[model samples]
Target: MISAKRIRIEKNQEVSANYVKKKMDFINYLDNDSLAQIFMLLPISERITMKEVCSKWQEACQLAWHDIKKYKCTNTIVRNHKKCILTQRYVEKVLFNCGIYLKELILSLICDSSIMPIIAEHCKNLKTLEFALVEFGNKNTYRFVEAFTQLEQLKVVKIHISGYNFQFRMLNSLPKDINEIHLFFKPNGSPEISFDSGIIKSTLFTTMLFNSDPVAPSFFSLKKFTNLRSLTIHRCIITDIIQEISRKTTLVYLDLEKCKTKKEIFTFNQLLNLEHLNIKDVSFMDIPNLLSGIFNACKNLKHLDAPDFHVDLAEIKMENWVNWRNLVHLNIRWQASDAIIENIIKHCNNLEFINIDELNSESTIELTKLENLNHLDFEVTNIDNEVMVAIINNCKKLKHLVLPEYNMVKASIFYDLSKLQYIESLNLAFSFKLGDSAIIAIAKNCKLLKCLNIKNCNITSSGYIALTGLKNLEELNIEMSVNVEDNFVVKLRGIKSLYCSGCHELTDTGIIQFIKNNPDLEFLNISFNTNVTMDTIIAAEEAVKNRTNDTFLAIKSVDSDIEKACHEASKNRTNDTFLSIKTNDPDLEKACSESQWLIDC
Candidate 1:
């Protein structure tokens, strides 16, 4: 039976091919599965063209496109197609479906002097319409705006007009009901005109706007969008954008990645609903009044990203900001200071993830005390036994850890971590002191360890022997582990995701022998390994494709059905999928493996 995806692929072939070709430069852009999933979303013509790219992509593309199209037809008001080409028949269909319940509608064409009238003649019920170009100079964009007046339910509209610049004065009014609007520029681009002069006028009600122009279309202001929920200003260098945003108290999310701001004293009161804020590549000498304003106004805030800045707060000043109890994620690059951590942990009780790249011994100890902490990402130049003991003793709920270079760590300190049973993800990158004992202690203690990253750890065959006991381990990253050989592969038979990149000591004899036997693996990254070649990936793929049902091969001494079911289920699923299987009655070892190390094993 021809699936819906196959039909859609046949309908949208040309555009899909171009998109795939453009993305081919990225080595990790999209795997076969991800591509298959994406292709299903494309129109039939696009999907068909994508299927022709390679025999391997055909079936997955066909199936995915079919399912998504079929699902959309049942609930959507928009018809699926690759690109918009306004024909008489297409125009008639749009006019007839003017009141149609559409979720998404795409329009693509080289808008020159002729295409705008055709689009205006149809497509009034558009929930989403993507335009390739808004033909300028022809004075046709104004007609397009007039047609949008009837699209009362229009939620999203994206227009790209490169060579033709909009007098925008012509676009006197925008669709007030539209929630999302994206404007793109090609050769000529949108005029760098801001609403500063009040030359352009519009009553278009849009929650978000993506303008390629240096200045925002004066249409966006505090009084313009009372119901605005979120705002994103990309590629624009408008000063005091935050000050303008402060007037919009309803804003919940704001992303200012490349924008710069003066040392303007800004308060967070206006953006009271803000929960997620991202400010990247912007420098500030002092985090002045930032924390206090955020805590006072955005009490419900959850995530904060403030990089390349250190903050020194007085204890009294810290008291006012302690009410930020709702914070769950924090990213700050500060000097290693114990007092700072004590203040931070004391306030944010429910913090789940924290990225403090520079950590000191005193701060690491304080980190161990945050009971609600789940993920800890930091880099340390020097870690002592006392700090290690503090981690195992306090950060009992920690599930992931990213360690710094090994030469900076004392080997004896790891022994203390043998008690942190909850740690499931462990990364020991760039380490020199980590040896067999440390690896063995981890293997023996972290029985529930799922991901172990020991890149460049200088581990040997003995380290492999120690790791073999981690039967439940799913991901093993020993990249650049200079001493790792083929024998290490033999020890990682149960790991579903393995990275042996730069393991110069590995040989084909060892790799091929294991690839033919270990079929449970889902991702194998052996890049930069002199011993491995293209044949290695091919061999791994073949093993995965031809995997046999071997339940008896699974270690069954596992205490609960969850572990048994997961072990058996892994044979048919991806590593990530298999890792998600839950165990309701996990063994004591698995339950205790949260952050504290060895509990049962």
Candidate 2:
């Protein structure tokens, strides 16, 4: 009784349905290992639903997460459309599946009350825990300890208290047998809870401020704990503690911050085994004497963070020069004369890491002399071309280097880094004169680079294209790069994070090419581009959706979606501009900005 046209349309519909069924059923052919790998990459939202699709997939999801040893629940979302790990549903899923196998747990929560109870009931094998939580006085402190008391294997706990007023009562209820504890809080009220200062555990604690008093003798004690190897105390009286620990030869690491002493001077000679001493923001009246004592005594000091070293040439006693040979890390945060710096370099010849942020004179420290340097940080510093050339030529063994924020070096001098074959991370974010040749040289020689940050250097598409050869690069920051365009992006591959904000030459089709080409791309910032438009956002979202949809054709579907995006763009994109229709659409602008916030925030 049906017409001939209706019969033809029905036949075509039947064939189309059969094709879709075949495509949907393709997942059943994948082996367990392959399915598990696919499940591992699926975002939290779809992965949960995908597991319920079939019994085989359920097993694959289980296998995918069974080996996880660390569980992190945070508000940081690294990818678009994926819910943050702090979401209760996601946290519950992780805890329910792999909580028993977890050895470490990290929680960065907004409100303290919501998830603490849920987390405490799981992760029995957790050996360490770190969290940031709000304070609620005594009742919350009791709840906090009760929640964690079940973790029998937990040995280390680091806590960051968040609240407007913290009485620091949480310390009393913390696990007593915990061998190592580090607590960070802004002490707001009176100091109430106390610890067994005599023979207590090794602890790194920031204590309550004692009403502007320079010393708080009765607040805390450090009479014993001979087994303690590391100690960090902040804003408390440290004179007596030092007197007590001076004889504790087992102590090797000490960090004192803003701690004052009732006495005018002290000595560290007794702590001969000290290897790492970090003193910051403390009274400097006795630091010179303390440092001189330390230099004279501690023969194995590998790490020293003392900015209070305002010592001059005369105080640079050659008798202590032998101790400098063992120094591996030196951070000059404040004053240092050219002669003192030269002596530091001359004596600490085996130094592996040096950060001098306060350098003013280009002649202060000769870069060429530091042949053994592995990491150099000159951030916020000023240096001339001669120093730049010396670094390029001499410090070739550097694994990490941060050039001055701004430099006047010529492109020719910047382009000849053929000797730095071992460089791993380089930040040329504001070196304005650097151009394509420099990037080409870096790509040719620095093949081991993993992080390259060139936020606003004078780089063009050719320079960016040269970067495509850096297969090991994981993060690239090209914010405000004016010359970047689609030809460079479409050819690039395998980067996790890319910041290309203010790149005006990129368009929707080019960005679509990038999104579909790079499967591992987690973050992309094409904000403020002059040519990108609404199609780019829709394409990015579509590509990500295809990836998380649990279909075998997800990647193949991306290309088809891009074709659709082109068609859609031609039909609707009349007002967008620069990485946008034209940068005038309010809705498109909001979308571009929000895309950047997932990672930047």
TM-score top scorer: 2
Estimate, for each residue in 327-439, the C-alpha lDDT of model 2 and write its tens digit: 88876454566666677777888888866666654643464577788887767677777776777777878889777777776778778754689989988888888889889
Candidate 1 per-residue C-alpha lDDT over 426-528 given as tens digits, one digit per residue, 9 for 90 to 100: 8877777777887878888888888988887767788777887887888888877777887767656676677776778887677766666566654555555
Best by lDDT: 2
Error of 2 at 78 (Å): 15
> Which runs of model 1 end up more than 4 angstroms from their true locations?
1-216, 219-224, 232-236, 261-267, 283-292, 315-319, 333-345, 354-360, 408-412, 416-418, 444-450, 465-475, 487-498, 509-528, 537-601
lDDT of 2 at 129: 81
For model 1, what is the alpha-carbon lDDT of residue 567?
A: 40
Count steric clashes of candidate 1: 43
Tell me model 1's lDDT, rounded to 2 decimals: 0.56
Each model's Cα RMSD:
18.6, 10.1
Poorly placed runs, candidate 2 (over 4 Å): 1-69, 74-102, 110-125, 147-153, 172-179, 184-227, 231-251, 254-273, 279-290, 307-317, 333-347, 357-367, 430-432, 512-527, 533-601
